[model samples]
Target: MNRKIVVPPILFIAFVGLIIFFIPMKEAFTFTEHRTENPKVYYLPLESERGFQIRYVHSIHLSDVFETYEVTANQKIQLLSMQYEDLAIGLPGSAEEGETFSFQDGLYTLTYEDNVIDSFVLLIGDVDADLAFRYLNKEINLKQQLERGKSYAFSVTKLSYYQMLRGGNLNDNRTKAA
Candidate 1:
């Protein structure tokens, strides 16, 4: 009935409520009914084979009329980036995702089914030495072919007008790879 008694209790409750709201509670980790029942389907790999993720391009798009895809080397590989027009026009291929096509940029080697898929797109604009895939992996550039599910890595600055060609990081000793 007194002001002090009622006021203190109310203030304490408000403070507790504010604290609970500010802090991130356990709801994020808690499993919901629907999520538990309907799990997303994922592709499984062979017992001995090691699969990489959709590496190569996280997401690629064309000017509007063309089609795009997020193809990876393996289950472990995920597309990192596409410098120019990631957009592509399908030339046609076998049942495998592998197909021949052209790229807006002059440089780059896209792999598929453990082989480098040759890509020779017409030069859209001025061909700059730096704007070529030769900067990434020489073996996987427009001239050469790349296989799908193979691991490859390189650091290149897309903004630069010219990029120097260099050796690629490949462990294939028997064959000459980038």
Candidate 2:
């Protein structure tokens, strides 16, 4: 009933709440990199997706990805050695090139030619998720296909202009009013 007593505590609580609300949370932010045509990369944040795809072009896309099946699929699979430090990726087991394996939540038909297990589809679902690829006359050896790592040899938290504008506040489902 006393304004003097009640208002001061209410004001203090409101002030503390305001301070807490304004502070930026690390988990609230996400990052992604978009490879632009030029050296300047145009990065951005992602809202949501069930999954995504990856590709390897030219010769060696990254030092980690391959030009052929240099690391024997059998050997790696046998030894249980993942290609990368993260367990989210690895290669499939096969005795021949055209072997198809379920990789990264999608179907991957790979080719084991030119000393590399280089190209494959990055799928998003158990079925009907892979995008069509135009390999032309290239041999598609699915047997040597490997699950491409999430890092794609390297993953940086992407903050695009869109994400920078939103400041990670958009995706946060918390009821904290802005």
lDDT of each: 0.27, 0.29
Alpha-carbon runs more than 4 Å astray in model 1 = 27-178
TM-score of each: 0.18, 0.25
Clashes of 2: 17
Tens-digit per-residue lDDT, 75-136, candidate 1: 22223222333324442222335433344444333334333222212221222221112211
lDDT (C-alpha) at residue 118 in model 2: 25
| Minimal lDDT window, size 10, model 1 | 26-35
lDDT of 2 at 138: 31
Tell me the tens digit of each residue's lDDT in model 2 across 136-178. Answer: 2233221122122211111223343333444323223331211
**Residue 69's C-alpha lDDT in candidate 1?**
25
Off by over 4 Å in 2: 26-29, 32-165, 168-178
* Candidate 1, number of clashes: 29
